[model samples]
Target: MPLAGGAVALVVTLTLWLSNMSRVPYEDALPTVGAVLALVGLAVLALRLVAGGWARAGLMSGVAAVYILYLPVAVFAVSPSAWMRGGLLLMGGVAAVLAARRIPREAPGVLAVNRKINLILVPIVIGIAGVVLLRQIDLERHRPAPDQAFAAFDGEASATSPDVWHLIFDRYGNNATLGGAYGYDNSAFLSALRKRGFAVNEEAFSNYQRTGHSVASTLNASYLDRLSSSAQAADWVPIYRSLTSSQALRFFERQGYETVFAGSWWNPTRRSGLADRNINYRAVPELGRLVLGQSAIGFALAQTGLAYGDGRGDQCRRATYKFEQLRELADEGSRKYVFAHFLVPHPPFVLNADGSCRSLAKATASSRRDNYVAQIEYANREALRLIDAILAGPRPAVIVLHSDEGPWPEPFVGDERFLGRDPVAVDWAGLNARQLAEKMGILMAIRHVDGAPAPAPASPINVYPQIINAYFSGKGVEPAPRHYVFESDAALYRFKDVTRELN
Candidate 1:
């Protein structure tokens, strides 16, 4: 029985760990592993107390088998509801227990068959785990390095090198996009920004459609295609590294300024070890947390009311925590380059326009368009408050309010289930014109403390370069070319020049 429990624990832990090894650290899997093992151990002990001999042994083995296979069944099975999957597993377990009670205790043939099955199963599980571990290790070893060669501005830092604040609001659409799609007029938000001396770009579009590519290009001041080859397109590790440890942060660090980051719960922007200071609200390790959220055990816990709340509740907590931290930064006296990325107006919409938590039931019941508008309205209110606080601070700051990428459109809302599909096969011609435009259209506005010589560019790629040129060195940075690039959901690293397609 002990051996059976150990085997089940090992197989389940290894499967969960290896599946998420690329995104999360090994240590993060320890808690979930321990919890799973403990649950299985408790179940075995309970069955032993109620039944003796072959009945106990059979029931223990049955529970172990169900636990081990539960994740695959829940994830790959036709049913999407976690509750439905859990109920199915529970029924299977009960059936196994009942059947085990009928087996004869003194049967030599039964004992021999059970012994042989255990021996075979243990070795097979171990071999599968070993293979997965080795493959993950190979993928980690071959991860690509980010491009570090940026045009350095060798100018002295004067009292006029304004404290820069790069504020990114995830999936925020421009006024026109908001109005056209969701019937929400965002001009009030734009007017508020304009009132604060920000040069709002009404016709601005993101250089890339995805967050990883858009942020990577913006911070590096170059496109991902130019920086790295297509070989690293399968994963997001390279792009994540670029966002955290890019030339942009390094540039500010060299200019006698402290780089403080208020990152979101998302892996790419969560916490930057490269920055002088990192602030995030998620207590658990990121990769492990994300992986656990998708697991069968995690689903069971959530369904049984053991969890704090659903994904919507967690999103609200993160968004609120990040925003509060941004508000407090107004009191800091140091010349700091603060980068606060807020995941708002995104999916799992949790907020209403009035700052009250939207009921999870209501949010889920609402249409995607309704949920988006509610969050966007809430974000607008919060953004204005943060902007006011920053502008009222003791020191002058250059604030760039932008979005990593615009809101996803119809038939392609924010779900990533389509990642495995071939990008080349997707019919780009069938994409809706308004939806495509909205996806490409992002919120971009910049406020220079002291008036700048040049206007802010439409593309995020030129944002950092323009800042360096305007304040640090009086030299001119060339404008980004008037072209849009689109990459498919499956192949994020592979680029398609969709400039003419959009036009």
Candidate 2:
């Protein structure tokens, strides 16, 4: 019984841990429930082990039921670590042993077989019904209705434009490094946008930290408080669904832009389905392997989740595929808003064109600097490619290229230095600016591309508003104040000095 209980407990703990790693809430509760249930299950398992009776089959059946339920759920929450998978397999062994022990006490072999069948069938039916309902609800909310054409991105504004390119090179740091390290000034990239008459907003800072938060906020134009509150809700599914159904799509579609989404590897179900057209890195064989591998592993372990090789070595190459993807969209003669989200500078640092990370990862701080510089350079080059394609085509286009948020600080990139931790309440009892900045305003850049960059001290919150105003809403159609400069909480950052450069 103890063994059976332990197995159950182990399964629950793995689920909880995986959920935590995946940033899912309820990490604490699941384990508590599992622990209690495990104890109960364990007692039954133990009795059969000792009595050498029909209890063995019952134990095996229960263990199987627990895993069949737990493993799939874990996959949705987090990628299964090697440990979680092994733990599940181990439970199967425990069940088999308990079942074998029951063979001896059976009054009739037929009756024992029938009981075993019933135990398995009951749980299986319940599980199937639950999964079906959950999936149905998920689809109803997120999936587009058959009558709707993927949020209609090609309305009026898309009518006479050349080609619109929204090149979002994920976290590609700025100009100086691009020029010195990549041996090419990112000016080449900027020059291309300028030639296309894009009045770039050179000083654009992303409103939020991290991709999920940043991207979610960008599309929905909602502040972190709302997003965080949503995240903390009873279910995250609604949050994901809400963002999917944002009014931004309808707005963009009304602007006459045919939006197409392209990315190396991400669950397109979230972003792609919302766009008019979605292309994945899976279209190319080499990139397809990485996409499929991640998907397969994710499917197997129920974990789905990027790599930008660190440094200057192959940053250009890293951006190449995305640039090409954007160019293809531009060539389609559709006034398009192509979201080319490149997964660079993320981690595991393996996808380098120059294969530099092999030697660089072992290097010290200075070497790490060189590696990051290399990545920045590559990012710049890719930016240039997309910009050139747009400039070459005839069109009155506005290019807005910016980071999702700030990079990590120090020996690592985007560390606490960039993202100040949420303050402990007592710490703020008497703290002021110095303390606040230490915990909040990590220097983040919102550098823009064409137009006269908006006065600094801009809010990442208003990025969407600014873009819409610049591209679609026209000058007089001022967005709400919250859109321009919202705070992490629902508070607002007052407009201050416009001349200050991001420190």
Which one wins on lDDT? 1
Model 1 residue 471 CA deviation in Å: 2.9
Q: Pick the candidate with the highest TM-score.
A: 1
Question: lDDT at 146 for candidate 1?
Answer: 58
Worst 10 residues of 2 by lDDT: 416-425
Model 2 TM-score, all chains together? 0.53
Q: Write the per-residue lDDT of candidate 2 for residues 1-503, one digit (tens) a residue.
A: 12333344344433333332222222223444445465556556655565455445454534544544444455435644756654554564466566645544554663555466556554554554455446445433543331231222222342433334444555554443333333434565565555544444443444433455455555555543443322322233333343444445555666656877665443322244567976553232222222222222223432211232112223334345556666765556556666656655433233333433423333333344455545555555656666667655555455556655434333223221111131212322233332222222311222333445454324444555655544443343322323222222222122122112233
Q: lDDT tens string, model 1, 1-503? A: 33455566557557766665555533344565666567666766676665565434644655555554544355447677766776766666666566666655655755665676568667967796788768766755655555443344444468778889998888899888888878988888888877778888887788877777788778877776644453344565666777877777877888889889887656678777668988777534554454455555556656664543254555677778778887888778899988888877766577887867777678768787787888898888888888889888887888898987787776664442111121123343356667568887889899888634336666788788778877887464655544344445446555666666556
Q: Estimate each model's TM-score.
A: 0.77, 0.53
Per-residue lDDT of 435 in model 2:
27
